[model samples]
Target chain A: MNCEEISELVYDYLNERLDADCAVSFTVHMDGCAECREQVSDLQHTWTGLADLPQEEPSSELKARFYSMLESQQVAAKPRPLATWFQNLAVFPLIPQGLAAGVLLFAGILIGAQIESGENVDELRREVRSLSQRVTLSLLQQDSVSERLRGVRFSYQSAVYDEEVIIALIDAVGYDKSVNVRLAAIDALKPYLSQQPVLNSMVTFLGKERSPLVQVSLIDALFGTNGGETLETLRVMSNDAQVIDSVREHVRTLLEESV
Target chain B: MNVTDVFSDNELMLRVRDGDNVRLGMLFERHHKKLFNFFLHTAGKRQVAEDLVQEVFVRMLKYKHTYRGESGFGPWMYRMARNVRSDQFRKRGNAPFDSANVETVELADERPAPAELLETDQSIGLLRTALAQLPIEKRELLIMARFELLKQDEIASLLDCSVATVKVRIHRAIKELSRIYHQITCEVRA
Candidate 1:
């Protein structure tokens, strides 16, 4: 082996880590070479010297300092109120982030009111809607005309689009004493116009209705449907003199417009 | 201490990374002394060694996400310790190979009692002085191989070199340290 190769084997030889064949070769090389042997002897002494250096113990204060530092870090890492709120928000689905902006804006008030209440969110939302529906139903039964009008307006807030609410609104349109409440009922029912029962009720009301404005509103409500039955209803209402001139004129214009 | 047997170091480190700070305490108890001795030998100052040990755990917490559980924790932590040591050198605006003021640092940490100082062997003191004078690369290799007891293969991985290269470097470093120690002992005798 070359001097360079002998030098590489010296560490393993001093540590007694050389493989069997390598150990034999290393001994043969060293037996023939004084310079490499002296080098190995010096390296052995240095390795022993390094091993003799004291294993110093760190000061006791170090442990105290480390625990203190860890404690401070834990305190710093604790989540704050704003971060907790953000974490709660992050739990919501991302699709809602795009389309739920208006829902979020409305729910934001509810969240603020119920923060830390630990109630189920779906349960809370259902509770709010159910309470609104109950209040609408109760107001519909009030003796005061204005209270019943409020009941018609409140029905619009029904999240479920409740059947009782639809029935109550139809009753308002057909039987309520105040024309304004009946008009409000038509406005409330506008959202449910796609329902077959609402359309049928409005068409049935057309023949017996006395108020020109209510008749006009119903005609306009049904005008978009533009069914053959709606056209016939308008035609019949147009000929009735009891219907106000303006109402009759509107129907004639609507009928003419439809054709 | 049995915790070390219960779970592997990587699992403990992963727990620490996953935000179980208590697991860090377990790891610290397991490896702090070895790390302390590494820093002590490298920096040659008890306070600096203690501070570096603290700094390593802090950076581990800060940079936990970077750790992938692919390798053993020892090499990963030693890599971070090297980085922490390098960052300190950068902040101080100095290269590590510059003459270390380690004698003054060692003297400042604690004063041995008069009898204890007299009883101290001259060769051990001379050895430490020789180690301090060796270049940082050679000193670190010797410290890792001789004191830290890391195998040649682990040192090779740590230095990003072949195992053959690590053996050659370690042999050369030991030779240089011997020459330095002899020169110091001669000067003392004179």
Candidate 2:
């Protein structure tokens, strides 16, 4: 096969799907042709590099949502269309619907009063932020991995970087069972890395984080701290036998660049 | 042994089609993450990717009766995923790039420091941006061929093209990807 023909079959050859005779012919061409060999090598390297890009696991909420959806689908699949229709009609009646509408109207009026005159918008926003942080903290403590991922996301969206949120995030990075949630925690902590506590939490987590993805993210986040402390932490991590080789190499590079 | 252990994906899917709804969970466990990654890489958004994964399985359930049990389940699932994604675009009347995570590209650009890993990640990010810049068809083809580990013939089957055509398209897609990746990286370096 000429280079052009080999190029067409290169990926197939690299993927090892070519038939035995074609594969031998391809190999014979590679033996005689340097340019084709280089082309195949470059393609192989690119393919390998693409594979090395970390595999991102979806957050646990996806599984939960899938199961819930499957359950509902199965329920809907059951032969009860007429029964369900009647049940819905019987349940959604006039008097209770009116009562529900009245309650909603009353709540709307109350909310309008609060928005208009109860407090300044900034204060109300502050209250909302605080409430969200509290909820985030509670969610972070939940056993459900998806809930914890949601909590980490909430922390990212939070306007307030309260110590509690930071601590919860730190704990998550250090101890979350799911790598996805911990990775989310690493992302959620990015904005707060400027704060001493957050930086300290990241540095502390660096020592304990076992996942290569989390370690790389933490390394990336802390690489900008611009101090001996960050370098020192990286230096220690670089030499740690437990740290992955790729991470250690990166840390060493960070050390050199920082110097 | 468990039924999942005893059956291939195609076989399991056949069971799923034949009123054995529980077998779908086995398939979900087998392929959902792969599907999620495919959508994540394609869409560049976790939430959207997750939703799309869910949507693919839901479509699989809805369309289970149509499985001919001929092609491998991976290719079939990906075909359904592509349909789900396109159907979404049609329903929303928005282009695929409308929801591209521009913030991620910006985040990658923000880190200007010179560490090997950082540079590596930045390169990956640049590649991602380049992939995003390609027309959606080229990007999807490259993603399935490279990342999803689908064979050329399988992809051709999925795309309804000849295997030879899929090979050249994938090669051209990689060439385009390399060009865009280097162009973006050079701009970043400059």
- lDDT per residue as tens, model 2, B1-190: 1212334789878988987665676678668877877777666667778899999988888999999889788788888998888887678786675225444422212456566666677666666677778777887787787776577678988888898899888777776766676677789889
- Going through the candidates in the order shown, the clash numbers are 0, 0
Scoring only the A-chain of each prediction against the true A-chain gives TM-scores of: 0.53, 0.52
What digit string (tens of lDDT, one per residue) describes model 2 on residues A1-259?
Answer: 8888898787788678889999999999999999988867766755666666666777778877887787677667766544665576567667587776786687677768867884659766865775686578768878899898889888865766565577678777877889999888888888878877667767777877788998898889889887567777888998999888999998998788866
Q: Native contact fraction of candidate 2?
A: 0.38
Roughly what TM-score does model 2 have, to 2 decimal places?
0.55
A131 Cα displacement, candidate 1 (Å)? 46
| lDDT at A120, model 1 | 55
Which sections of candidate 1 miss by over 4 Å? A81-259, B1-3, B94-100, B107-120
Instruction: Return the clash pairs for model 2, or none.
Output: none
- Which candidate should be chosen as best, given DockQ against the real structure? 1
Question: Local distance difference test, per candidate?
Answer: 0.77, 0.76
Which candidate wins on TM-score? 1
- Alpha-carbon runs more than 4 Å astray in model 2: A16-38, A80-259, B1-5, B98-119
Give every collision pair in model 1: none
